[model samples]
Target: MTDSAEVPTSRPMDAWLDALSQPTGSPGGGAASGVMLGLAAALMGMVAGYTPDVPAVVAGTGRLDAVRAELLEAVETDGIVSARFGAALGLASDDPAREQRVREAAVEAARSVAELGRIGISLVAEARTLAADGNPHLAVDLAVATEALEAGLAGASLNLRANLRLARVHGASAAMRAGLDEEVGRLAAARTQVERIAAELSARLD
Candidate 1:
C-alpha cells in the first residue's frame, strides 16, 4: 500500500481500487475516464511500436506519449478538483456566499472534465487510422484501445454534463454556454464511431 499522501495512480492496484471503493466522491467518474484514456493511449502506443518503421506510426506514437502523460496527470488533478467541487456543494445551504462558491466550484469542475473529454475525443481519429494501418496482428489490441477510448469519452461527457448542470452554466459566457451542448453531442458521436469500429474488429477476429 502506498502512503496516504500519494495519489491514486501512485498506489498499488489493490490499494487504488480500495480507495475507489470508499465512499469518497473524488477519484470518481472523471478520474476513471482519464485512466481509461491513458489505457487507450498506452495500447495504441504498443500497436504503433509494432510498426515503428512507418513514419506515421512514429509520429502518432509520439503524440500518444504526450496524451498518456496528460491523461495520467489529469487523473490526479481531476480528482482533486472533484473533491473540492463536492466540498463546495456540501457547504451549509444558508451560508451567505454559498451561491457564489458553488458556482465557481461547479464551473471549475465542469471545465476540468470538459478538457478531459475533449482530449479523449481528439484521439478517436487516430484510433480509426490505426485500425487499418497498424500491425494487423494487433487488431485485438486496437479493438480494446478503441473500446477504452469510447468508454473514456462516454464517462467524461457524462461527468461534464453533471458538472454543467450543477453550475447551471454559471460563469460561462453566453456563447461558451451555448456551445457546450454541441460539444457534448460531438463527444457522443465520436464515441459511437469508436464503438462501431471496436465491434467490427471483434466480429472479424471472432
Candidate 2:
C-alpha cells in the first residue's frame, strides 16, 4: 500500500483521472468502480435537488449525498485494501503462513467489493423509485443516474469475480461462499430492475 500516510482522501478530478490513466495497480478497476458509483450517487442527488420542494425529495437528496461520500471513501479504501492483498501474494511461496494470509486477504477483498455492489443496488432502486413517482421533467436525470449505477454495479461484479476466483482457489469457507453468492444474486436482481426502469424512461423520452 502506498504508505498509510499517503492514502488519498479527495484529490482534484484531473489528478484522479491522471492516476487512473497510468499503468499503476494501486487504483485499479475496483477503485474506478467505486468512483463511478460515487458519481452516480451525486447525480441522483442532483436530480432530487431539482424536484419539487417536498420533504421526501429533500431528505432523499441528503441521503444520496451521504451515499456519495461513503462511496468516494470506498474508492480510497478499495485501493488500500487491494494493495495489501497484492503484498500478501508477493510473500515467499514456501511460507504456509504467507499463503494463509493471502487467502484471507483475498476473501476480505472480495467481500469489500461485493459491498460496493450492494450499495450501488440501493442507489439504483432509489433512482427507479424517483423516476416512477417524481417530477416527470426530471426523468432524464434519473435515467442517467440509473445507467451510471448499473455500470458501476457491473464493474464491481468484474472485480468481485476475480477476487472470488482467488477465494475459491484458496478454499474459502462454505458460509463465505454462500454469502458472496447471495450478494451476487441481489446485484443481478437490482440490475434487472434498473434496466426495466431505464427502458421505460427511454420510451417516455421518445
Candidate 3:
C-alpha cells in the first residue's frame, strides 16, 4: 500500500508531496486534491480491473476510465494548489502586518484541500455503490476497493484538517473557519455512511 503523503511527484501521490516539499514553485492544494480524487478513482479502477470481460465489468470499465481522466486533471490542479500554499506559508514572516495576508493565503489553501476532500469522499461513495452492484466473481476486488477508498478518504481528511488548523492559527476570518467546519462535518458524515455500506458489502462477500 502506497502512502499517499509520501508519494513522489514524479509518480503521482509522492510526486505531489515532493513538489510541495520543494523550494521550487510547483505543487499546490489543487494538485493535492486532484491526487486524492485520483486515488479514489484508482480504487474503482482496481475493482474493475479485477473483473474484466463480464458485461457488468465492462460497464464499470467505462466509469473507471472517466474517473481516471478526472483524477489526472485533479493531480495537475492539486499540484498547483500545493505549490501556491507552500509559497504562501513561506512568505509569512511573523510580522503583524503580514499575518493577515498569511491567514488569507492559508484559508484559500484550506478551502482547496476541503474541496478535494469532499470530492474524494464522494468518489468513495460512488465506488462503493458500483462495487456493490458489480460482478460477484470479483467481490474480493470490491473489498480491496473499499479499503483503498477508505485510505484515500482518511488521507484527504488529514490534509483538509491540517490546512484548516493552519488557517485558524494564522487568523483566518470567522466565516472562513465556519465554512471549513461545516464542510468537514459534512464530509465526515458522508464517510461514515460510505464506510457502513462498504462494511456490509465486505461482510456479505466474506
Candidate 4:
C-alpha cells in the first residue's frame, strides 16, 4: 500500500487511490481535486502542443505546463494542510487550545482551497478556447479535460464551503468570511461554465 502520507505523484494509481479511499483525511477530498486540476492542465498541454498551426494555441502550452506543475505541487501541499486541519479539529472540545487550534486550521484550510479554486478557474477560459478552436481530432480530449476541470472546481468549492462553516463557528472575521463566500460563488460559476462547454463538446462526439 502506498503510504497515505506520500504525495500522489510518487505512487501508483491503485496505491494512491487506495490511500485516498481510506477514512484518514490526510489526502482528503481537496487533494483529490488538486489531482484533477493537474490532470486537466496536462490534457490541455497536450491539446495545445498538437495545435502547431495556431501560434497562440501553441503558446498556451507553456502556461499549461506551469499550471500543471503548480496544481500537482498543491496536491501534496493540500494533503499536508488537510491533515493538520483534521488534527487541530480533532482536539478535545475542552482542551484549552482547542478553539484556537480549530480557528487556525479552518483559516488555513479555507486559504488552501481558495487558492486552488483561483488557479483552477484561471484555466476555464483556456479550456473554452481550446474546445472551440483546438484540433478537431482532439475534441474528445478537450471535452474530457473540461469535465476534469469542472470536477476539480466543484471539489474545491465543496471543500471551501465546509471550511467556511468551520471558520464561522470558530469566529473568523466577517470580512474574511465574506471573501470566502465570494470564492465559493466564483468557483460554482466557473464550474457551471465548464460543464456547459463539456456538454456541448460531448454532444458533438460521434
TM-score of 4: 0.90
In each prediction, how many residue pairs overlap at the backbone (N, C-alpha, C within less than 3 A)?
0, 0, 25, 0
* Superposed Cα deviation of residue 196, candidate 1 (Å): 2.6
lDDT of 4: 0.88
Per-residue lDDT over 7-107 for candidate 4, one digit per residue giving the tens place of the 0 to 100 score:
56645777878989998898899989988998899898889878989877877888888899889778888888989998998899899999888888988
Model 1 off-target regions past 4 Å?
1-10, 169-179
Model 3, 1-206: lDDT tens per residue?
Answer: 98978865566546557767776646643454455457657766766666565566556676667776866765566556666666676774865656676677677766766666666665654565565566676666566666655666666667678877888887777876767877777767767866876787778775
Give Cα distance to truth, residue 135, candidate 3, Å. 0.7
Indicate the TM-score of model 2. 0.85
**lDDT score at residue 77, model 4, on the 0-100 scale:** 87
State each model's CA lDDT, in order: 0.83, 0.79, 0.66, 0.88
What TM-score do all the candidates reach, one by one?
A: 0.87, 0.85, 0.70, 0.90
Clashing pairs in 2: none
Winning candidate number (lDDT): 4
Better of 2 and 3 by lDDT: 2
Between the candidate structures 1 and 3, which one is better when assessed by TM-score? Answer: 1
Give the poorly placed runs of model 3, Cα more than 4 Å off.
1-36, 46-64, 92-97, 204-206
**Sliding window of 10 residues with minimal summed lDDT for model 4:** 4-13
RMSD of 1: 5.0
Name the candidate that leads on TM-score: 4
